[model samples]
Target: MQDAIYAPHWNRNAHSVICVLRGRAQVQVVDDFGQTVFDDELQQEQILTVPQNFAVVKRASNEGFEWVDFKTNDRAQISPLAGRTSALRAIPADVLANAFQLRQEDVSELKVNMERQGNTLLRPSRSSSQWRAIA
Candidate 1:
């Protein structure tokens, strides 16, 4: 959908080969070290391959976004990082605070914000048109 944002997630057991079928999108993939591995704008007919456990997020253009995500497995299990049903929701606030060196209340507030954004795919906010790629 137009302006929609796919939440950051990584497959637990499969690699994904994504082919953009319609519109355009801003895609960002992150490595384990929290460094961005790939970040660029994908236009119609473009394709992107994301390895297992490599977090990926996408924001749709105003024209809307559509794609076919081919996974290695018949049913790929995904773990979302931003959402109400995300892994962050399962961890104790104190644990998260300790791990991030943040206050427990701050961690709690962060979780609340995630919930407010809606689970998984988020609603449209702003349209992005700039194009940049980082290796």
Candidate 2:
């Protein structure tokens, strides 16, 4: 596991089994309707199965975490909900702005931030605080 939270994402072609090897983790999986499907803390030697295409996020405990993930497909395509790999970036700015109910300028600013961060496994520091708030 990584120290930073792995932002919600899904693998189009794979299901995954994660075995905790060290420390602990908080795992959450959600359905298409954004309903929580699973939420729990996993400690060393525990395992969790993530069904194919289910949106999931994993956050390491304060002591940090490590896990071995086995995926059904060797070549899984991950679509992130935030950050550089987010599928939202592929949408037209005007369409995205309308869908998100945000001003075009705000959408542009979001795009700029996304581009600047590049592909990161973890959400940025600013967003991480929001996660903590929810936790």
Candidate 3:
């Protein structure tokens, strides 16, 4: 799990309360302005609440991360901010370029790279370049 990441995502209609079962993870919650709402290292037994539509991401520690979460909606729906099942993949490269002020090639590179990577639980390499800065 050292290379594992929960990926950046947001619940459409549910709020989640998560409790770490073991290991440690750096949890980050961001606002619409791309500002950090909460950024903390969660250890065993620690808990956090992610509000509905609020983006969240988790990076595992060397020992890996384990957690359990409950959502307000029984059939929770999630929209990942990165990876194949993300809006980034659905967006046209030209639109991405215009929105982020990036070159078309750069946007294509970002999207293509992420499309090859699955959504939800991802195990990105240490050297992998993340395009989270753009969106």
Candidate 4:
């Protein structure tokens, strides 16, 4: 796979185990306290566990990456924190603006930028230099 991000998301109903089958990947998982619980690069044959309800994001390296995902449930649902399907869109704009400590117009712009991406699996872009910086 090309350099891509799975996006920050959580599976409320199931835990998951991911095994890296090829290339390399960077994985980060945040706990309920909003602290990063795990952040590391994974190599071929490496495995990582993602507990249910924790938010996680995975980025494949520029060389590309592949992995097998195993979930506790036969059907798992994901709630993305950022993307067109993000839960943030469901919140009232005023509330979101207040929570983000931004002007309503700024919040609207943020929403627009997020929606413009339109993809849950994000491709690397010049604007996403920060994510690309991860080694």
Candidate 5:
């Protein structure tokens, strides 16, 4: 299997937990409608939890990134209680672009990087509207 990389964003109604499987990841979980809550770099096999809404996670560029996401919903098989939560939110392109340390040239390079490492698991060209609903 290959690693997955993505931009992170926050949502008020969703909560998610990410567990690293192989490589490194960067995460920022914030509950504030206007402030930074938590920020750090997570190495291999680390686990992070987002209790409230508005959290962001981005896979580091220099390291291979692989992780599993456990999304939550009230009607799902594993529902979260009052203090628990679940859901996935789309990270805006502008916000995502800001978090990464790359120029326009890197976009093509990112694909090259993935292709060389056999990590092209996500089809970024597809419309977000057609993607599966994860929560």
Candidate 6:
């Protein structure tokens, strides 16, 4: 119904990977014991991942800026952005505009299930004798 707001605190389940389309987004990451570690701006076509259990902050670079925010089931307190750190900013409800927003379910379903080389879905390693030596 309304433009989406970036979560204020760190998310436990929703790992975030932000990709800017027409605008920009500032991704803020806080380290363990609650210290700001990452604060950077991502422009169009750039990709970044926020690992689980890390404090993250996202905000549009300018008014009407559009970007896609990927979220998972993990959730953080949905509150007005509150912090004095240079990396985080509280976006007023009016200026937060975007073309599309992906909810947790949408992101969860779209996740890539990459299997390792020797998992159940992959062939197990065979004995060295089974392989012909490279001649």
Best by lDDT: 3
Residue-pair clashes per candidate: 0, 1, 0, 0, 1, 2
Residue pairs with colliding backbones in model 4 are: none
TM-score of each: 0.73, 0.73, 0.78, 0.76, 0.47, 0.44
Local accuracy by lDDT, each model:
0.82, 0.77, 0.83, 0.81, 0.48, 0.46
| Worst lDDT 10-window in candidate 6 | 115-124
- Candidates ranked by TM-score: 3, 4, 1, 2, 5, 6
lDDT (tens digit, per residue) of candidate 2 on 1-135: 345687678878899898989998889998777789999998999988888888988888878888888999989777788777687767889998899898999888777767766543563355554322111
Kindly indicate the candidate among 2 and 5 with the higher lDDT: 2
Q: Residue by residue across 19-133, what tens digits does model 6's lDDT show?
A: 6776666667886567777888766788777666676666555443456668765453222223332122333222332212545443232221111111111111255222111
Estimate the TM-score for candidate 6.
0.44
Ranking of predictions according to lDDT: 3, 1, 4, 2, 5, 6
Q: How close to the true structure is residue 33 of candidate 5, measured as C-alpha lDDT?
A: 68
- Name the candidate that leads on TM-score: 3
Model 4 accuracy (lDDT, Cα): 0.81
Regions of model 5 farther than 4 Å from truth: 1-5, 74-135
Please state every model's RMSD to the true fold in angstroms. 6.6, 4.8, 4.2, 4.4, 10.9, 19.6
Of 1 and 3, the candidate ahead on lDDT is: 3
Compare candidates 1 and 3 on TM-score and give the better one.
3
Model 1 lDDT, full chain set: 0.82
lDDT of 5 by residue, 5-43 (tens): 353444345466778877675666655564667778887
